[model samples]
Target chain A: MKTYLLKWWQTIRISWSKYTAYRLNFFLQVVGPFLVFFFIKYNLWSSIYGEDTGQLIRGYNFDEMMQYHVWTLVISLLGQGYAAMNLSEDIRLGRISSYLIYPFEFWEFHTAGFLSFQILQIFVSSVTLGLAIFFGFLDLPSTMTLLHGFSFTFFMGFFWFTMQYFTGLLAFWLEETWIMRVLLSIVVSFLSGYIFPLELYPEWLVSGLKFTPFPYMSYFPAKIFMGVETNFMMGYAVLAFWMAVFAFVNHLIWKKGMRLYTAAGM
Target chain B: MSNKVIEVTNLTKQFKSYKKKPGIKGSIQSFFNREYTTKKAVHDFNLEINKGEIIGLLGPNGAGKTTLMKMFTGIIVPSAGELTINGHRPWERKKDFKKKIALVMGQKSQLWWDIPAMDSFLLLQKFYELSDQEFKTRLDYMAELLGVVDLLHVHVRKLSLGERMKMELMASLLHNPDVIFLDEPTIGLDLVAQENIREFVLDFHKKNGTTIIITSHYMADVQALCKRLVLIFDGTKAYDGPLEKFEKILGNEKTVSFSFSEEIGGCDFIDKYDAKWNECRNHVDIRVPEEELREVSKKILDLYPVIEFNTEKMPIERVMKTLMTNPEVLRQQRENLSS
Candidate 1:
């Protein structure tokens, strides 16, 4: 446990240094999504309400609609690296081989590394979120009220990170991993409500998606921030269950895959 | 007392199949029916290495030298072998097993590429939980022994091949493992650098009394550091014994060539010396047993026909080639060729 803590501390140190060194790119990663969604919001509103459309949107003024878009963008930050395919890269380069030889559990290293990267993400996301708050562009509740929303996002982020690692390990079995990643992206995009609200889905589809690990990735975070009228407790329970399942499944696959790990060399 | 630091009884590892053939048709067909090909990499290997002994594993490519090394290091499991290293089954990956040994591959650098090599050394120091004083003492000792003190501050990518290798050797030894597995330590090094490494390995073994297992393409490394070697071919042991005995089994015979000024060769002269006229113009080749080489060379020079001549030890390449194919050699050494 002491070694594990030390290693995690080291990983955080490295990531913190990397984040500071590449400050501009880290900032751009957060801000880039805001700009993207702003235009997307403008286009959607113009289509629905016409040229004379007031800043009002979805029955709210232009500010409200823009705020919704920005909220969704900030929520989407939780899903970014989960879909980035870092583990698949590790598998190809045989970087994972180094972990296999060590005494630590592979998942422990993955989690610690992810946590460090997420530590950096917190700063980047906060800046973007802070900007929205400053411009009166987002409706953040008082610190006490937003605490519930923050916890919801943190657990969901943790769950999604584990699931993402499990999905990436599938690259060991797949020949061309892009196909699997695309299929996963489509599922997450539609089911988790990255593009739209989960409530927008029909009754059966929304219920079915509630069973998937994807909602813990994007939908719950969005719901928390937007104060989407739903059972937050229900979402958290479902996220916890999926996290346990992903952990169990990841353990099973890793145990089986190790028997097949034909390490690359002459 | 434990007489052996490493003991094995028929250790074998057969890798399972997981990579599917590409194509839509094949993928669909294989969804219902799966095929597996188990490659038995290390097969029925048995040996007992005592403490402080140096063992050399020799083989052609794909002869399972590395497979044995990996199994010993706990990186891979054996399919059908009972082995113990430092009273532990290596595959168990116990902290004790990890602390007892370090594995180094010649062409691979475990040093962090972007950072100074000392950082990696420091990490390993922390990893092994060495005390600050102990770490410094061992670090200084290894750096001095391996001649890498000057290269510690340089990034691994900036160091030359020899300098990086020296650093690697120093890093692995920093923990003072009871055993060290070197897979091709002298590869990609010049003759001088190879000699330096060879000398370090020998002196390290003598000083630390650490058992060593080295697999390399350079036979000179084996001849210099290891008196005994285990030769594996096609995933099985071909020969195991002292270097001189293996060389004798190899029949280190020599072929001497004499270049005559004139192509006028006669059978009368050839028969006296038992020389054969090879395809070379004005060149006569003679095969002499290693013991009789001196007498034959003296007699050949005394003959009037000789113009210029040179005697050389048989090349190891040809000797191994002949040894692998010789019916007599196989009959004497009844080891299976395919594991």
Candidate 2:
């Protein structure tokens, strides 16, 4: 609808103000990781062979590893671009209850909000990531890749990002979700391939990851950039399977959670 | 066409409340004890509201007023009941249903707290998916009516309470909802702010026949805007009737107050007249017996040089406090918890 497009545009116009409200924090957020990743990649390459040498292992020579780390670091910026709070916060603060009185469906409104934030995140993070990559502090094997790796990353990010949303459902029942948040980091680091690449992991872990969506978010796409793209059809198959799994699981939890959700003050 | 826009049958809500023990040890023990409490928040309540009707839901704290509103909005599921709004079940939360309803709470803000109100309005436009012409027309009208067009550019956080409330009214009415839920919309605001909102609400109803269901601890809100009231005392429908009937039944008899220049103890005239009285440092306050207030006031004025005197009745706040806490009423209230 023309109205809908106008509305979406209006939503983004104020995003600059929201983003600028925490300019210092946002800039620091980008730069902090930028510096850390640069040092880590440099140290990794040097430590692999000798002080003067480059490369990590057999397949990944010094040049390749250096490039890979730089690229991955830029990629990691996408994840941090997200500004999200648990869905439970909406319930806890009575915002969800207010939304209910409106004519719109709850999930539809939430989806709109989610889509809005994601668009904003992608825009802001891409700028930051591009800058980081341009500075030559971080590098990844490009292979002149256009949409190959990027497109896969997009699907993987969506599939895994939804998992975070479902995890938001846990807040309905749990008095405190601190433990869940901590454990979530481990899951993200493990499967999203933040700490280690999927190929570098033990064979059993890599195989096991295939069953979950986390690797699609971080690891699979990282490999694609390293010239290790999966079979396109197989990748789509796995992506579709994870999407279905996440959707089914999320729907199930949401249906059950609504019955139990007080949407009242905690 | 029938005037009724809201209909309900035996509406009930029961929320699960997890009990907590005091200390860490008690918490561990409770895990083993497996204790939980189920609170019956709203019970078997039935009502029919016509379009253009503004009804007040009056209760003390935790009286299930908010819960009832939430149910109508389809935010909270009722434990057992049937509720329909404009012929649609509220819980279905259909697009038509959403377009016709709006909710606002005074204590909580729907406006994005950090951004200017205009920004928040823009987001609301998307949520409601209003056409540009429709959005602009409504925005202009609401701003004109509420006198908040200039204020829109200011951040909501920077605005005063009254300004924020004005903006809130505009935001809620952006879609021109046919049904409005006001949960303490005037709470914690100054008298001026309260009056402004009340005026806007009354005018809104007059113009659009928007059925309004308002809950507030402030009885003035009810007194000024609502003719019929549903009083929920302790999570149950304690009283449901006309405002005049509620006042008459709940002993809405006027109480006169006077402040003497000195610390005067008890009033002998009050004793003689059998009038209930309170004396605290230079003030002699009396709850005028239903029939004898004016006659007694005359005699008092003749007897003592009353430094300050008013024949006005006691405030609604005091009336409800006494009604809820009195010993005889408390016993009766508990027995008929929900009917």
Candidate 3:
């Protein structure tokens, strides 16, 4: 058990070194997206609200809408920041052959890498949250609310990771998986209310999303941070169910894919 | 008890690929109704390698050398038949099986390119569950032998190819595996680098008595290291024997080249020996039977103004070239011998 833990710890250390190898690139990759996305959303919403700061669209004034967007950015950085780009590339290029030869399993190495990336993402999200609070874009929530929001978002991160891993495993058959990832991101952004609050959508559409995991992914967590939604049991139960489903599906895909993997370009 | 580290019986691997034509029309057609073809990359191969033996696997390109190595190392599963390495079914990929074997591919870099090699080595040390003392001792010994202690801390991408290759060798050997598979470990390097790698491998194998299987297009690697040769042709074993026996496969004839001071007319005596003359007739190469080599050389010296004369240095190289150019010759020879 100790040796296994050491393997994981050592892999995580190596992954951190790889991630921070290029200081400039690391900085840009982590913080750049949050800034750019927040900037765009801030301007777009400001234009939509148009010289009427008192206008309320679905129980949110301009200030509250901006605060909600800020929380969405934080949730995104914390929960959905990791991607399986390297995993797919490794499969497509046959770089995973070395892992097969090692005593460590391939999934163990990649999960260790994800854990290291999560550490970096947590740091980045904390700084983003601090900035948003300092810039008056967000107000401080109660201690319990903060705890619930962070705990749920971190749980959602694992679900996101499993889904990405499923797509990455498709590299055994598909020539390119980035298109799938892009499509997933767009769908999540629209359905999870990352672009706009779910309250602004039609009642039927909001109710339909409640049956899926999309709302709990971003909208529910953002509401938690904003102190408007306090129901954590249903969100946890729904996310857990989806997570189990993805985990099982990802396992099946990996088993089938390994049989078809020719280790091309080795 | 018999001492065999690797055993195989009728092992085979087949690859399936879709045939697609060129241009947009072909692509559209392939997308709708693809024609899949199954190729037997390795077919009914059988071999038994004894412990602590170095075997050279020689074949032409696309002859399934890499595929065989991948299967041996458990990177890919075999389509059929049985194979066992170190008493474990390699394709099962048990942790104990993985720990007992190592594979190095010269065409690929296993080291993490973004970080220093030391970091990667440390990670491997943990993965292999090596004691700190053992890891350090092995690292120091390999670093001193390869003369790359200073380059270990540098990023792998920044190092020269030769330097990186040395690091790769060190990384693979850190676990002191029982069997090692080398797939062209010295390709695309300078002569000195190649010799260095060969020397290091010989030293390592001598000290450790590890079973090694190597594949290379450069016969120098084969000549310098392997005492046994296994030839593969079109995904099947063609020859398996001692190196000396393989060198004499075609015939026991020695190729002797001579250069005269001035052009001279070829005599019937020289023509009787299958002599090939240069344009000016001042240089000629003759094939002489082993028994008549001494008599023929003396006669040539006495008959012509022989400026320089020498026999071929590497007989296996010549044999390999002949076999690669006309593989049918080997098949014919095998048939004739069998008959």
Candidate 4:
């Protein structure tokens, strides 16, 4: 256990160095996308609420809706991409052989790499949040809400990581996973409340999304921060279940995939 | 605690690759009726490696050197037969099994491309569960030997290929693995770098008694480090024995090259000796038996005003070309010689 922890810590240190190596690129990556989305969300929401100041669309006032947009944007900026892409690239290009010779397991190594990346993301998100507050685009949440929101957001981020990992593992069999990548983007954007609030969707659409893990990644965390009544335990339960499912499936796929790997091109 | 660290018997790995037809209709037809061909990458291979031995795996491209190495390293499973490294089934992939082995692929890198070499070394140290003192001692020793102690902080991407390869060696050896697998470790290095790596490998093995297996296109690497050679051709073992024994079977042939002081028309002596002439360099080469090298040189000197004359072992490229084209004749020669 101590060895594993040491390995994880070293992974973070290495990844942190890589993240900070290109300081200009790292800062621009976060700031550039955050600015673009902030303006778009702010403009779209202002146009909607400008025509009807008294309208209570989906139980959100103008201030509350703006708050949702800011936090949601923050969470999206800090989100992890499908690491399976890296995994697949490694396998297809024969780099996986290097890892196979090591004492560490494949999934564990990639997971440590992903975790290290998120550690950097969390740091970036904090800086972005500070920027948002300074720019007068976001008001600080209450102490209690901040605690609940961070906890939920952490699990939400993990859930998304697992899902992305599971989806990326398809590269073990399929040579090309771009279609799946595109599909994931469409599904997450439409269902994870990244583009719009889940409350804006119809009753049937919301009901269908409840069966998936997308909304737990973005919507519930935002709703919890607003101090709105959410089924916190239930959301946690679903996230935990998906995490378990993805873990088991990933293990099986890895075992089976090891047999299929050709380590092409030496 | 056997002296033999690796043992294999009848090991074979077969890869199934499907043919891709051209155009949409061909693709559809092929998809429906997939024509998969089974490529036998490693065919009934057998090997036994002892402690403190450096063995060279020699072969042409796509001749199963890398595949066999992959199987030994537990990257891919063999379709049939048995393999054991350090008394562990390679495909089982036990942590203890992996802890004892290191693989350095020349075409690929294990270091983090965007991070400093030191960072990758630190991660490897933790992954190998080494104490800080042990890690530091090993890293310092290897870095000093490879002359990369100061370059450790430089990003791997920014380093030269040879520099990165040095770091790779340091990273692989930090844990003192019992068995080291090197696949073309000197692929793209200059002569000086290659010799440095060769000397380092010899020094490291001398100190540590690590069993080593290396594959390379450069014969200098094989000649410098490996006493034993495993020659594979067409995905099968063509020859396995000491380097001296294999050379003896090829009749101890040497390439004798000559350069005349002035360009001359083709001489009857050249035709009589069946020499190959390079008109551009005013050079001529003749194949001579090792026993007759002195006589041949003397005769050539007497005939022509020779400015330069040298005798070299048959080039490994030529050796491999002959082996690939006439495996049966080589095998017969070996059998006859042994008998």
Per-residue lDDT of candidate 2, residues A1-266 (tens digit): 77655554655555546655667876776466656766775676666667634444746666656655655655555542343353557755656666665544455555555555556556655665666568764453454663677666666556655666666667777745557766886777766667656667788977877766666666566667767675656666787787788788889987887788776661
Q: For model 3, what is the C-alpha lDDT against the true structure?
A: 0.91
For residues B24-52, what per-residue lDDT tens digits would candidate 1 score against the true structure?
Answer: 97887678778877888887888988888
Candidate 1 colliding pairs:
A55-A61, A55-A62, A56-A60, A56-A61, A56-A62, A57-A60, B12-B79
Worst 10 residues of 1 chain B by lDDT: B330-339
The deviation in Å at residue A131 for candidate 1 is 4.1
Give the distance in Å from residue A58's predicted Cα in candidate 3 to where it truly belongs: 1.4
lDDT of 1 by residue, A65-164 (tens): 5655666566556435553366766665555655555444556656766777677667667777887788667767667446766677778777777677
Ranking, TM-score, top scorer first: 3, 4, 2, 1
| Candidate 3 all-Cα RMSD | 1.3
Question: Candidate 3 — which residues are off by over 4 angstroms?
Answer: none
In model 4, the clashing pairs are none
For model 3, residues B90-171, the per-residue Cα lDDT tens digits are 8889999998899998999999999999999999999999999999999999999999999999999999999999999999
DockQ of 2: 0.56
Clashes (N, CA, C under 3 Å) per candidate: 7, 11, 0, 0
Query: What digit string (tens of lDDT, one per residue) describes model 4 on residues B289-325?
Result: 7788788789879988899988765465567667777
DockQ of each candidate, alpha-carbon based: 0.26, 0.56, 0.92, 0.81
Kindly indicate the candidate among 2 and 3 with the higher lDDT: 3
Best by DockQ: 3
